[model samples]
Target: MSVKETAQEVLKKIGGSKNVESVTHCVTRLRFVLRDFSLPNKEEVASIDGVISVIEQGGQYQVVIGNKVSEVYDEVLKELDGSDPTDKIESKAHHKSLFDKFTAMISGIFMPVMGAMAGSGMIKGVLAILTITNLLSEESGTYIILYGLSNAFFYFMPVILGASAAKYFKMDIFVGAVLGAALIYPTFIPFASEGELSFLGISVNMMDYTSTVFPVIVAVWFASKVNMIAEKFMPKDLKFLLVPAIVLLISVPVTLIVIGPIITLLSNVLADAVNAIYNFSPALAGAVIGGPWILMVMFGLHWAFIPIFIANMASQGYDPMMGLLLANQFAMAGATIAVGIKTKNDKLKALSLSTGVTTLFGISEPALYGVLLPNKKPLIAAIIGGSFGGVIAGIANTVQYSFGGSGLLGIPLIINTSGIDNGFYGGIASQIVGFIVGFALTYTWGFKEKSTVDSDDYSGNNTLLNTKINVNDILSGEVVALSEVPDKVFSEGLMGQGLAVIPNDGKVYAPFDGVVTMIFPTKHAIGLTSSDGIELLIHVGVDTVELNGVGFKSFVASDQKISKGDLLLEIDLAVLKQSNFQIITPILITNPDKFSKVSHENNNLILAN
Candidate 1:
């Protein structure tokens, strides 16, 4: 489907444009705040044409639409009359639980900057590897370039954090960014590095503010609020220019003179606390670090952890948290690949395979949205696997001497040849064992049967028959038996054999006990997997995936077992037909190649057993 149409369909399914309280997009999903979570036709909404999945987490209703989420979000905004998606009524201050609020706040601040953060993090990892291998020197020009590339983000993090914080605060982001940039101005760095002194007799402390965190974020957040207030007083024509000027004039000096030092001190305290805890109990530390890794990934909050990882590496010449995080990512990727291979549905298989590939390359949104979240089992399995691996790494005192990539391929970075006594092999062994165990556990226990049906009956001969009928009868618009459709694959077929009567009503019924495999969010197509291992794809109309699987309801689930003729799915085919959807229902064997001589008769009247 066209991207525009896809966006429109999603908007309609989620209770139309009016139901959306607010909308925003990060790297991979359209994050929506709705007036109510209980929207009409939620099942149907989920079946919408372009949606990957619907998730309710962090007090927001999220639609997973792959990497083009921002483009789709922009299109959605344009359709909403240039409305800013982030402008919503303030949620109750205390409505969310403490933990939820914390996660939400962290996620909102970091999500927007995640893409750049990951790029820089990966560069640093690569540079570390290069330096450790002696492929590059600390004094080399090449090393300088790579180091600069990695360091640039940290050195100017306030700018990025400011923009993100402004979004979170619902204020002028550009203004906030300018305020942040002022905090890191080169002229101030010299004074910041010096001892405490009086700035015009007010007494200011010169501290090393480079690569600092929290202070700039807090400053920008306050600046954004200040900008918002200034914007209200300024004329609309001058608001944009005046608001920033006013906010910066007031905010920058306050941040430099007051807020920066306070926040920097707080950051140090927090860092010290975390370090103390890690020093006291490294295994507990690993669990603490690894446990929330997936949760961090879910909301894109992991970016907040990057600065700490880098800080640890720089100061200690090693960081254990990153090694554990690497194992966690690899475990998830491995589990996803396993599930992709185990799934039977063609569409699901394709999604899983594609997601798996992307995950291996450090892009895990596809896997997270397409497979892990929906299946539940795989997600849990991955978490368990990650925890196990993390604990092992932690117990082994595994540390990455160099910042290496966070995945299976980056294992060599953990080897501390010059510093640690064990030659880094212990960390390597810990990661390998953790990954293997995690994969094995996931492969064995991660895939719960999404369908509750006998696999054999769906694939075996049934108590049905095609007596006799003419293909001309069907062509002549007669209510001929489905067996007369003239396709041997459907007429006398074993895999997807089902009666296809030109029903007087636009209703659909389950052919046997099965779970609804897929009801296209557009409601254009439906797939079912019978308990007897038969996978069925029934396209109600031509180009129905274009419909976004709207107006369809699945009483069953992906791996649910059912009895023969169970009520698996309900669809308003009449609505579909009226809405420009084709009704050429095709019930084909998704796994036809698995069996031999799968036959059907095009000119026969078939009777259900």
Candidate 2:
């Protein structure tokens, strides 16, 4: 489908534009906040073309659309009520947790500028290399221009963040910029050297706001709140002039006196704490963080560390945090390549090799979710490899001078401005160790091929012609009668007759599998036809579809051929137990009429003979 069609279909599936309170996009997903959480059918949404998956996380319905997310976001905007994203922000009546709001706010502020920020960071890295090698003279006009291009963004970070923050806070963009500019205004910035300045005869604290993160966000939030109150009482005729004037007079001084210094202090504390962690035991810090870094990325939890990374860069001119985790990408690539080399399946080999290439470019998601994760053991190997390399890097005190790619292409970013040093060699050595260990371990024992099911297991029409079948447990859980289920639809045998299970583990396995007929969009349910003609519907929990694919993960695709005991899905029971929904999963024989006797076995197994 075209991008526009995909956008429209996604909108329709999510109860249309009217249901959306607001929408935003990160690198690969379209995030939406809905007025009614239970309005959309997740199964239908996931089945849409161009969508990779659906994830409900951090109070947003995230549609995974891969590289086309930005295009789809634009198309989505065209279908919304207004051109300004702030127009939709007015409808954010839904409540989000403090952490959720903070993360969302930070991401919103930074995402718009990330492209430029990364490019500028890369330029700085490149310049550092040229100057170190004596290929470029720092005093030359060319060097000066390049340095300005690279440094200007970080030098005036407050202004950039202010403009972005205004968009996030639904305030006047220029007003936000002016407030940011006022902090570093040529005449005023010198006062920071003076320590304190008098404003209207009142003592005002002075601090440089350049390259800061928190101050502008707090300032814009305060300004937005002020603008909101002003709009309530001020005449609309005078709002254009008087509202901005009032906001500037109040916000600029408040920010200069209170917000800037406080945030700067807090930022310093945070930076110091990070340094303390590293200083206490750099190896432990590196191993602890780097070992599970891929898992953190998988669950979208890595966003929590971004502020720390930014703060470290702004305050210390370089950060060791990213360098500690740099081995992860290499480890992932190594595992993928190992899988590619060892797998007998041509399709698996092809995918493993291709995704391995992507991992080298610092795009490890493709390899992670597609290759290593599904294989299980290779992921562990990668983790082990990454942790080992991380320890070495920590010992060497490798540092990342700027944000850029995390793979071979970003080697320059680890180069110290002083000259080639132990840190630079440590970074290169870490990647080497990560790759070799990951590859060696995976190739030696991390992967073992599974037995394949015979093609004659079932008929083309999904009916068992002559063979008998036994339906094993779809998951490891306590089996109970279907009538014991709380919901009327399943308790009353309206959907079909079968047993219900209280799962002890989150994984779902295939029972007498032939082909996967369907997977529910929310991934809470599955439809399967056994080789011997038993058609079963494995539903995870009661009313789980309302959760919108949050804790559920489907491994098999629709119509895929599979063997019995193959992993079909994984659910986070912990996340579900917190909700009101019951975790009783009903495994129903949807085509019960095909047999006269469908007996339930005593060993918690279903026998259709």
Candidate 3:
């Protein structure tokens, strides 16, 4: 197949150009950020020609194409350049499981800016250490600037979250940003402390929303819904301005009065429940938390633990749960380091080594997705190591004085204000024990290293590009761009790419050797599946399906074999014109993403090889 056709097949297998939000290439992979997870067929993607592997990591759909990925990436971009991609419409049709969907959402939302957030959290720890040690005075200008730098992202967490959430939720970004800002606005902070509040005669349950997760997410969600609903009644000319304006007006009030308080209360209740559990038994709590901690991190279930940890620090003097959970990070990192050393495959070694470095810095998505889960034995070893470490931490009553990442930066956060307290020393000891345990266990028991696939050996099963069109002559009609169609559904290229033809004659012919998949009862359209695996849908006229065969006749039967250029249908153009039905017949490749190119020329659509 030509390079152009290969890109089309690749794009289709990954859920099409519309599903992709962005595309780029690293050394060996075509990285795509898809709007919906369920739309891509992984099996088909893996079977594509020139693809070495498929990896879904940190919400990216990666096609491992070896060294030629950049060439393919360039082609993929060219093929999709003119298409105005849409997201939310495709998202609603996704069929992913709830856990998978939520994992994707969290990964997509946080992965982009996690470095900034983590860096700021680390600085907060630095600030705490500096103040406790008297190295920086609280009243000093140096300390004040550092404190502001450390606190900014956390203080404006709602706005940051809202902007990201809006991108994922398919709403206007600034609208999401403004809504988030309004939630944590300085004026509203005082209102939450008051007894009661009301907005437009509606009772408002005052709740502190600063640094909270669910409120802005809920607000953006409602805004997206409102935007969709408003599109119908909104005038086309005024839609660009009025739809977002109306959505913001409704969503902000609804969020403050209805959504914000409910989610905050839930967060508080969750925090209290977790604290009660921690108070029940420290060792048991550590065991339970550590054993599945990486798994929680993997699916982002650990986000639920964040507010709880903060609450413990706020209500009490310090948080023990976060310290207890710290072993999991070092343990996983150690296990991955062992994998890097033990693996025979060059790619696996590189992946494990880089991911190990990432985990050492408290980012475990790379380690979990790229190594541990794929290598089952190492994951088990890491869990066991973490469990042992957690027991030691719990017994030592490990606690942290300030917020920081769970990697090396955590050590300073747990340091004692006094010389050498058990809480601080024990916390340090637990991590060392966890790393040794994990590295030893994994190095001794090892993972089964799966060698890379020889890309040349596993050739693709289909011959889509090899099959000839049989009728090479230009089609007899007036071929037009998809946007020229009267219906928005067709004009938007939503039903798949092809052309609307104003046919001078009634005849419609089979474009390739295929089996008739269906003949519409009304006879306005015929569906055929090509021998090479293409699907073609030929509609005789716009909305003519409603005519009930009044102005159309289909000559093919379902399951019948068809040859190229065989007469399949005839339409009574005069009857359709008289009845006010459009005679602009549309020849649509219903699964246009399956082809390398769908181009209109001299009254013909040349599906490229």
Best by TM-score: 2
Clashes of each: 39, 1, 0
User: What tens digits encode model 1's per-residue C-alpha lDDT throughout 1-609?
Assistant: 777887888887776676676677765678776765555343354566667666666766778778677778888887787556566644333255666655566666766666676677667666766767787788999989888987687678778787778777877777767777777777777775565656557776656555556777778767877876887788999986777788888887777778888877776676677678777877776676664588776764564565566566545666666766656766677778777787675666787778766665556677876677756667777777667767777777777655434565455566553433352555555555545655676678766333211223333344343222232222222233334543322333322443344434444556565677776655545677655555666655444454566766656655556565455456676766676443445455554333432334553322222
Alpha-carbon TM-score of each model against the true structure:
0.65, 0.76, 0.61
Winner of 2 and 3 under TM-score: 2
The most accurate candidate by lDDT is: 2
lDDT of each: 0.62, 0.79, 0.72
Look at candidate 3 and give me any clashing residue pairs.
none
lDDT string for model 3 (310-393, tens) is: 556555647878778778888889999999998786777897888787777776656765577656778888898888788878
After superposition, the stretches of candidate 2 with alpha carbons farther than 4 Å from their true spots are: 81-95, 458-469, 472-609
Better of 2 and 3 by lDDT: 2
What ordering of candidates by TM-score runs from best to worst? 2, 1, 3
Q: Which digits, one per residue and each the tens of the lDDT, describe model 2 over residues 200-304?
A: 887888877777788888988998898889878999899998999999888998888888888888878877887889889888987987768888777666766
- Could you tell me which 10 consecutive residues in candidate 1 have the lowest summed lDDT? 468-477
Whole-structure CA lDDT of model 3 = 0.72
